[model samples]
Target chain A: MPYELYYWDGIQGRGEFVRLALEEAGADYIDVCRGPASEGQGIYAMMAVMKSKSEAHIPLAPPFLKDDDLIISHVANILMYLGPKLDLTPEDQGARHVVHGLQLTITDLVAEVHDTHHPIATSKYYEEQKEEAKARAAEFIDNRMPKFLGYFERVLRQNPKGPAHIFGDRLTYVDLSLFQVFEGLRYAFPRATAHLPTQYPHLAALHDAVAKRPNIARYLQSERRIPFNEDGIFRHYPELDKNAA
Target chain B: MPYELYYWDGIQGRGEFVRLALEEAGADYIDVCRGPASEGQGIYAMMAVMKSKSEAHIPLAPPFLKDDDLIISHVANILMYLGPKLDLTPEDQGARHVVHGLQLTITDLVAEVHDTHHPIATSKYYEEQKEEAKARAAEFIDNRMPKFLGYFERVLRQNPKGPAHIFGDRLTYVDLSLFQVFEGLRYAFPRATAHLPTQYPHLAALHDAVAKRPNIARYLQSERRIPFNEDGIFRHYPELDKNAA
Candidate 1:
């Protein structure tokens, strides 16, 4: 059976990380929430699992995956499970843990990115927290962004296999996730990230390389790739994207 | 050789979650950063691993565990590795994944708690962002706290074994971590959490039970259990603890 991926229909958000891995691997999966309820799919289908009392494993939030009898949640946890199955990770146990660590770090950066737009409360709207967001974004662009990007760049440079991939000689799910992060940041902080090509040469190169992959290129050019919008974790607010002038 | 845990010496922070697991399991481990630099076991020792060129698994931050040749970071990742070795997780693969997912949920809660004091910039001091933090903490107390706590309470209530433990009949590292979360929240927001005992009776009971565990009880009263202070993730600032009243 094809895996059932349950997430919000509109935004890329955290679900995109899981989606990218599936897309790149040419894995057969259904975006459950995107389908109609008449077919036993949609938000209600996803909610049924979330609210299910029969299942011992309960998901705290969405972006959960179901394969036959097994269910998994948390982007990193789900990706870790899929990575090996899809041949997106290394064969060695130690190398697998390193890739998992990188994925967790990406999750950390994503959380910080989400906070830049919603500094005070996730429940509140962006307009309500616009002022605080401006200040938060300033600090993020100045300090946190460089810190995280630089760390990834350092990891790439230090990779024994080469700087082409975040891990060994072959492509891993982490490389794909990094490509998505590069896309989201460039879209969200156009002005703030204008110099990324020069500042993060390895990351820029990896991003360019991932975009050229046959499966990923087809997916990106097709309607499958979601547009970055105000509703997503990485949202563009010109006021919040300003760099020091 | 015993396991080597590298974390910040002064604060419990994220490291405490790992420390609690080790303490509860009665595992032989060294708090690397807590020892003196003369013996190559202070902040420098932790920094050395972070900056080391020889190791393939470079940790992005602290709270990394070194077991023989393997080095694992991220609290949940380390706990997942330690869970089975320490006999804290179920033997079934599916059940183990559920436990790991639950631990990841706790990690999510802890991150939100940290943001209560550092709402804007983590690099900036709490005093510099007092106003923003006050607003953030208000929402956390009113909305996020109850939302997370309620989720865990539901998980407990729905457990097939009973509500006595988070998973099965025997205690797990999750129980120990939850106990720490409870202690930290109580210390951080005394007034805000005064009604927790009544509102979340199961969690309160779990907290009490974990404390009554002989090893854990001794750890709590010992010097190893660092007191919650302004430096830690959960800090008590009266101005940030105001509830609806």
Candidate 2:
């Protein structure tokens, strides 16, 4: 049976990290929520799984993978489970832990990115929290972004197997997720990340390398790749895209 | 050699989650940063590991576990790594993933709790973001808290084995983390959580059960359990603790 992946129908959000991994590995999987409701595979279908009291392991939110019997939740958790199966992780156990840590760091960064726009409340509209968003975005551009990205850059630099990828010499799920982060940041804060290549050369190169991968290259150009918009986590608002000091 | 856990010395912060598991299992581990500086263990010692260029697996922040040569970061990741060793997880692989997912959900709630006090920026003081914090906290109390706590309550209610524990018939690290979350929420928002026992009886019962565990009871009264303060994630700011509507 094809692996079933459930997330929000629109926008990449956290699901894209998992999608990218699947796409890169050419894994057979169904984007369940994106399918038509007529076939019983849409948002309602996804909700059925979450709302099922009979299900022993119902996930709180989406981007969960259903492989036969097991239902894995959380983006990082799903990726960690899929990594070994997809061969996107190293064979060594210790190295796999480090890679998992990197994915969790990405998870932290992604949450921060979501907060940049919705600083006050997820229920409130962006216009309602525009002033607070501006402040949060400025701080994100100046402090949080650099700290997270720089840490990744340092990791890439310090990799004993060379700085080609985030870990070891080949592509891991961390590299794919970092590629999504780089893309999201650039799309969200064009002016702030205008000098990304100059400032964080290692991350920029890693992004470039992932973008050029045969499968990832095709995935990016396909209709499956959703465009960044105000509805998504990394929404671009010109007012919130101030250049970093 | 004993397991070495590295985190900031004063406040429990994220490290307390790991500390709870260690204490409950009666596992021999060193709270490295909490030790006296003369003993080659303190904040400086923690920083040395984070700042070490020679170490390939440097964690971005603390509350990391150094089990011999392996360094595992992030609260959920650390607990997931230690859960099996401490026998805090179920023997079934699928149940283990479910428990890890629950822990990751706790990780999300904890991050949201931190954001209540620091809506604008972590670098900025609470005074600087009091207004935003109030707005955020109100939402957290009204929306986020109920949603998260409600989900966990349902999980317990829906447990097949029993609602005595989160998974199977045993107490996993998730229960311990949830216990910490319950304590933190009560400490941070006493007025807001005044009806916690009435509203989330399952969780309340679980909390009471975990607290009564011999090792845990002793650990809570011991000096090792740091008192909640303004320095930690769940800060008690009266201005941000408006009662739920």
Candidate 3:
């Protein structure tokens, strides 16, 4: 049976991270929520799994992967589980832990990115919290972004195996997620990220490299790859994109 | 040699999660930064590891564990690594993933708790972002907290084995972390969390059970468990805790 991935239908959101991994690996998987409701797949079908009291391991949220009897949740946790199975992680156990650490850092960075727009509340619309969002976005662009990106850049530059990937020489899920982060940041903060090629050359290069990968390259052009939208974590709003060099 | 756990010296912060697990398991682990500088363990010692070019697995932030040569980062990642070693995780691989998923959800909630006091920027003081903090805290108290806690409550209530623990019949690292979260939330939002016992009885009982554990009870009274303060993630700011029954 094909692996079943459950997530909100409209936007890529967190599921895209898992999607990227699955797509790059050419893994046979069904995007359950994106499928037809008549075929017993969609948002309601996903909700049923969460609400199923019969199942002892029901997930609290979507973007969970259902492989046979196992249900895996959280992007980093899912990636860690999938990494070994997909042959995307290093062979050594210690090195695999290092890759997981990198993915967790990316998770932290992604949360901060989401807060740039929804600073006050996820329940409130962006317009309702526009002033606070501007303040948060300013801080994110000026300080947090550089701190996180610089850390990753340093990690890449310092890698003994060379700077081609975040861990080891070959591509891993961390590299794919980093690529998505770069794409999202560039889309959300075009003016702020205009210095990427100059400021973070290594990350820029890695982003370029992932985009050129045979599987990832084809996946980007496919309809399966969701486009950046205001509803997603990284949303573009002119007022929040202030302070460009 | 004792396992070396590195984190900022002063506050409980994230390190307390690892500390609770160690204390509960009666494991020999050094709280590296908490020791005196002359003993070759302090904030400087932690910085040395992070800044070391020789170390390939340098952690981006602390609350990291140094298990001999392996340096593991992030609270959830560290716990996931230590859970099995400490015999705090279930024997089943699938069950361990469920525990990890729960831990990751707690990680999400903890991040939200931090934002209640520092809504704008981590670089800025609470006084600088007091207004934004208030707005964020109100949302947290009114919406986010209950949503997260409610989900956990449901999970506990719906568990097949029993509601005595989060997963299976044994107390995992997840339960230890949950105990810390409850303690932190009550300290930070006394009035807001006043309904925890009645609203989330299972969680309340789990908290009580964890505290009653002989090792944990001793650790609570000992200097090892730092008292929650303004410097930590869960800060008690009256202005931020405005709306409470």
* Top candidate, metric TM-score: 2
Off by over 4 Å in 3: B243-245
| Each prediction's DockQ against the real complex | 0.67, 0.82, 0.74
lDDT of 1 at B50: 92
lDDT of each: 0.90, 0.92, 0.90
**Which consecutive 10 residues in model 3 chain A have the weakest lDDT in total?**
A53-62
The fnat scores of all predictions, in order, read: 0.61, 0.79, 0.68
State the lDDT of candidate 2 residue by residue for B1-245, as single tens digits. Answer: 78899999889899999999999999999999889899999889999999999788699998899987889999999888888899999888777777999999999999999999999999989999999999999999999999999999998998888899888888899999999999999999999999999999999999999999999999999999999999999899898887899
Higher-lDDT candidate of 2 and 3: 2
Clashing pairs in 2: none
Measured with C-alpha atoms, the lDDT of residue A45 in candidate 1 is 95
Q: Whose lDDT is greatest here?
A: 2
Question: Which model scores highest in DockQ?
Answer: 2
- Candidate 1 residue-wise lDDT, B116-197, digit = tens: 9999999998899999999999999999999889888888888889999999888888888899899999999999998888
Q: Better model by TM-score, 1 or 2?
A: 2
Looking at model 3, give its docking quality level: medium
lDDT per residue (tens digit) for residues A99-200 in model 1: 888899999999999999999998899999999999999999999999999889998998878899998899999999999999999999999999999999
Rank ordering of all candidates by lDDT, starting from the highest = 2, 3, 1
